[model samples]
Target chain A: MPKIVDHEERRKIIAKATWNVIAREGLGGASVRSIAKEANLSLGAVRHYFQTQEELLEFAMQLVQEQVTERIMEHIQSHLPPKDQVLNILMELIPPEEKKIEMQVWLEYISYKIRKKELQKESVHEVIVEILHRLQKAGLLKEDILLEEEIVLLHALIDGIALHILMGLVPIERGRIRYLLEKELNRIFVE
Target chain B: MPKIVDHEERRKIIAKATWNVIAREGLGGASVRSIAKEANLSLGAVRHYFQTQEELLEFAMQLVQEQVTERIMEHIQSHLPPKDQVLNILMELIPPEEKKIEMQVWLEYISYKIRKKELQKESVHEVIVEILHRLQKAGLLKEDILLEEEIVLLHALIDGIALHILMGLVPIERGRIRYLLEKELNRIFVE
Candidate 1:
């Protein structure tokens, strides 16, 4: 009997390889052939899994979104208090030492989508908005806080810090990121 | 007598053309040929002005930084009060409708630099830090405000909002941006 190849597993393997290529060479250099080589697969194999470059890149982006959501879900299910739990989720969005590759891939994807003028709705922003709403309903946010404006500020601050960290434009250590984030959270969250 | 071609003017024109190409095709697609074509100049003329792509891009980035610095200086010199002066300078960093192309080119340069591991010191961050320190020295900031932390937060928030607006990930309008920024300023600045 012929050997059975797991198509789903193969697709995921290809997507992860695509991420690596983007992290190293940027989205512009992520050609189908290059991705296949990085994945240690033949050109035909990659093509069989993804017909076009756009299709492959789209799948890669989807995989990244799903993985990030999974991580966030794990944090939500943990036993930490809501405040620390929220802080942890925000930290997850900003890449630390190990998560660097993943976030770098994400940044490239964002840049590509922006240039193409086909930017999809950023799910990260929605997650933040939803979390803030949840906290407000639980009476954890300060009474004087304008919910809508706070949402906008917090979202922007998180993304801006992430970009700065990624670029190494500012010398932001992990402790500093935590401190800055915790301070902002304290400003809006009820003590 | 031979026609006198102003060397400085020609170089500036080439740099502007480089910015236009970067804004439209991204840094990856910015080539000497493309930039020359965009400038409606001959290839030899572009080569005469900038020897290599790196030199051309470097000159282009310098022009952007200088232009931004010049605008900030103008804000500093204006008759607006300290608070309004700071707000106006911050607004200049975030691309208004007319400043979109310049910021687009800047974003592309940033993305490219990050990939190449060549990110230089971002002058904008320094300017923010300096301005905050000056305000605190003038006793304009709240007594309880942590100067260092506030600086980091403000820098991140501004850049983050700029990124979101550029990407259209959030429907942030000019008024909303001003409101969000002013509110943050209110939080830190003494009434």
Candidate 2:
């Protein structure tokens, strides 16, 4: 009998390789062959896990989002205070030291999505809306602000900070920018 | 003298072609040959204007930035009130209908700059700092905010709003995001 490969483990391995390829050479470098080489697997082995490059990239992008969500959830759970929970969740979206490469890879994927129809699906938007709804329900968000506008602004702020942080214009410390974001959030929510 | 080719006019034509190529195929598709084809000019003609792809892209990027700055300056010269001037300048940065394509091309250039070394040195950063300084001088910015942090946040907000506007998450009306930004700015400046 042929050995049964652990499908989930294989997916994780392929996704990690995808992240590495993206980080080292930008989104253009995350080809099947490059990912295979980064994964230390043969092209056939990589294909055995992901049948096509598109499928591989789709899964890789989803995996990055999942990782971000998971980390945020973990941080939220650790913080008992509601304000701390919100702040911690926000921090998770920023580049944690271990996840800097992942964030960089994600940025490349986002840029690639701009011109490509297949990658422009609104799954990320849905996830963002869900988070906003959660915050609103928890009374963490100001009632006066339009949910959609607030959500859009939040996403933009995150993207902006990510870009600046990557460019080294913003320090990694969780002080000034964090205060600014939190303060803005407070302004939106009624006392 | 072969008509001397009107160097400034030729540069504008080349930059416009670069913009078209970016709009059509994105930054990845922006090449000398592609730009020449888009411009309906010979490869030699394009090469005569720009010696390298990097030089062409850098020039195109600078052109976009300058266009934005010029628009802002023009709006400021209308002699509006201080708040109106701040709002108008900020509104100009958002994807105005007349300049949507140019703004999209500019975003692509910024995404490209993420992976490539900047060719124009400190000019872009300096210009942004100057804008921030002007806002501060106008007493529209908080005195307590650190200049570096303010600049970073301002740039991020501009970029973030630009992304949202392009994606259609926010309304195209300059008044909407401008109002939100102005509110935030007021929060910072209002004693």
Task: Estimate every model's Cα lDDT from 0 to 1.
Answer: 0.82, 0.70
What TM-score would you give candidate 2 relative to the actual structure?
0.85
Q: What would the per-residue lDDT of candidate 1 be over residues B1-191, giving only the tens digit for each residue?
A: 98899988887898899988877666667888998899999999988867665676677788888889999999999999998999999998888767766767677677667778897677778899999999999999999987877877889988888788777755657777887788789989998
Native-vs-model 1 lDDT? 0.82
| Highest-scoring model, DockQ | 1
Q: Write candidate 2's Cα lDDT for B74-153 as tens digits.
A: 97689777667766777776766567667667666654565553424333345557777877877777767787776777
Q: Which stretches of candidate 1 lie over 4 Å from their true place?
A: A6-9, A137-144, A170-172, B136-145, B170-172
In candidate 1, what are the lDDT values of residues A61-137, reduced to their tens digit? Answer: 88888888999999999999998999999988887767766767777777667777887678778899899999999
Candidate 1 clash figure, as a count = 0
> Taking the tens digit of each residue's C-alpha lDDT, what string does model 2 give over A1-191?
99898888888998898877766665545678888888888898888766664576576778888888787778767847665676667767777557677666666665556556334445445556777798788777766778877777777787778766765566547676688778766766657
DockQ of candidate 2 relative to the true structure: 0.45
Q: How many residue pairs clash in each candidate?
A: 0, 1
In Å, residue A99's CA in model 2 sits off its true spot by 2.1
Judged by TM-score, which candidate is best?
1
